[model samples]
Target: MKIGILTSGGDCPGLNAVIRGAVLKGIKAYGHTFVGFRDGWRGVVDGEVLELPREKVRGISKQGGTILGTSRTNPFDGPNGGAHNIKMTLVSLGIDALIAIGGEGTLAAAQRLSQEGLKIVGVPKTVDNDLAATDYTFGFDTAVQIATEAIDRLRTTGESHHRCMVAEVMGRHAGWIALHAGMAAGAHAILIPEQPVSAAQIATWVQEAQRRGRAPLVVVAEGFIEQGQEAAHSGRGLDTFGRPRLGGIGEKLAPEIEARTGIETRATVLGHIQRGGVPSAFDRVLATRLGMAAVDSVAHNRWGTMVTLKGTSIESIDFDTALGSLKTVPQERWDEASLLFG
Candidate 1:
């Protein structure tokens, strides 16, 4: 069988590892040929492909980002979109099955395409770790590690200047990255979309930290909302998924904190810095495991299903189960982390 593989959505660490694991396993165990789709669903729509062999995948596990490239292109759109058109394209390209590695949007498209008679297996990949089906996604650990390191460095600078530093991490709807990284970095305050906080309240936390002679550190998620207001909007327009661009909340709060508390304040947007560079050991191993599990699912002809991590084990669950809802940071987690807050 010739399997077509594509990495869709935002690029992340461990993407190359996933590709390497799948290709190596497919070639050695089943003699299955592989083709990589470039720029995600756009590649599928345009039938753009690159050949994949064992040699092509050598030593990619330690590498960051997808060698095959990626994009946020939606497969159900455009002239050659929808299930029928995609199936016709696949037939023309001789792709027997598809392994779609991506987050929510990509897997949702894969689920629809499978419903429309395409053979597809999904491997969950989200730096946010928001998917409900998996205990954790492949890129989440790497992102957290990056964010944590950035916050740690920020802490040192904040102390040096006696400044209140607000560090923003990526999180559209959930706060897993911000929560874990903030706690790890000993942030004085943590803000997330799930918890709306007022600028005044944050100032109080800053003042309290200042009282203790500590430079205050604040970690905010991109989608976080100030109290009694909507979430911060980037005004940069929406993506292909029709979701608003979320960011700049930390920047917005920096002035407010400085004004209310009269403290020297700075806002550092971690931005795409969290997405680039080598994945942590945890992420590489998890991504490789999911990649191998995805191919094994394909070998068994398990279509419309995705491989997910369930605690210490990697398991397969129906795509709907995974997409039913997002896995958010629970209240208990926030409360536990808050105990250390100023």
Candidate 2:
């Protein structure tokens, strides 16, 4: 059998591991031939391709970013989108199946293609861990660890300056990174999108910490918007794929906290630093397991299914189930994290 693979959306660590695992197993166990689609869906539309073999994937499991590269391209929005051309190109290339590795947007795209009669399998790859079916995505742990270390470092500087420090992590509809990293770093407060935290509340927290003669360290997700503030970003106020922009919330919230609390405040947006780096040991293991299971998913003809980590084992679920809805941070989880707030 011949298979095509592509990585889409924001680049993250452990992507190469997934590619390596899939190609290695697909070749040795199943004797399958592999082709790679470059730059996500654009490669599919234009028929840009590369051959994947064991040699091509060597030593990439520990590397950051994707060897095949990625893009935030939304194929559905264009008049000459790849979805239409993908079917034609696949037929011409004799590609029997596709393996799409990405987060929510990529899964939704794969589901759409599946409905169009394409043989596709998906692998969860969000650092946000917001995909519904998977218990945890590959890059979330690594991102959390990176953010936690950054918070730890920033806490020192905050203390020296006696200033309020706000560290922004990534999360659009979820707050897993902030919650986990905040807990790990002992942040004074952690803000997430799931919970609508007021600027007044944040200010009060900073003020209390200051009164107690301590610097306040806040961990915030980039997608977190102040309850009553307008949005600011460069994507025409759109998100990664034309949704209303939710970025710069940390930047917006910083000044509000400073004005309200009269404390010297600063913002540190970690931005892509959380996404680019060597995969942690945990992510390498998870990505490898997901990749191995993905190839097994193919042998079982689990078309339109994605490999997910549920508890201690790797399992497969239908793509529709995985993409049914975003796995947002639950209210209870936020409440538990809130105990440490202020």
Candidate 3:
């Protein structure tokens, strides 16, 4: 079989690992030929492709980002787009199937394409770790590790200056990164989107930490909103997918905390940095396993399915199952982490 692969949506740390894993396993085990689509669905619409052999993917497992690059180009957007055009392009290129490695939007697109009779399998990719079917995604571990390191470094400066520090991590619709990093870094307050916290509550936490002779460190998810002010804190704008851009929550919170508590406060938005570095050992192994499983699923004609991590093992599930709901930070998990807060 000749398989075509594409990495879509925002780039993450373990994307290259997934690509390498799939290519190596597909070539060696199934004798499958491969081609890589450039810049996500745009490549599919425009017929832009690159030859992906075993040699091409060599030494890429430790690398960050996708070798074929990525983009937010919607597959059904312009002229020559849509399922019929994509099918024609694949047929013209002699591609038998597709492996799409990306987060919700990409997988959702792949699911629609599969429904249109396209042979496509998905591998979940997100630094947010919000996909429902998977226990965890590839880039989430690396993201959490990076955010934790940032929090650790920020703690020293904050202590020296006797300031309240707010560190923001990514999570547009979820708070997994902030939750894990906050618990790991021993934050004084952890804020997430799941629970709308007020500025007064955060200021109280900071003041308590200061009273206890410790510099306050607060970890907040990018999507976190203050109670009763949801509509006022919009980020830059909407993206190609029509979702509101999320940022500046930490910046917005810092001044409020400072003014309310009468303490010097600073906000550091660890934007993009968490997703830009080398993946953690856990992410690499998990991505490789999922990639291999994706290829196996494709070979077995499991269209409309995605490869996912279920606890200690890799499993394949229908795309709809994965997309049915987002994996959010549950109240129990948040409660557990909150025990350490001031």
Q: Rank order by TM-score, top first?
A: 3, 1, 2
Worst 10 residues of 3 by lDDT: 226-235
The clash count for each model shown is 0, 1, 0
**Residue by residue across 47-137, what tens digits does model 2's lDDT show?**
7899998899999999999988788777665654656677877889999899999988888888898888888899999999888898989
TM-score, structure 1 vs. true: 0.98
lDDT of 3 by residue, 116-202 (tens): 999999999999999989999999999999999999999999999999999989988899999999999999999998989888888
For candidate 1, the clash count comes to 0
**Once superposed on the true structure, which residue ranges of model 2 sit more than 4 Å away at CA?**
76-84, 229-236
Candidate 3 regions off by >4 Å?
none
Model 3 residue 143 CA deviation (Å) reads 0.2
Model 3 scores a C-alpha lDDT of 0.92
Q: What lDDT does candidate 3 reach at residue 283? A: 91
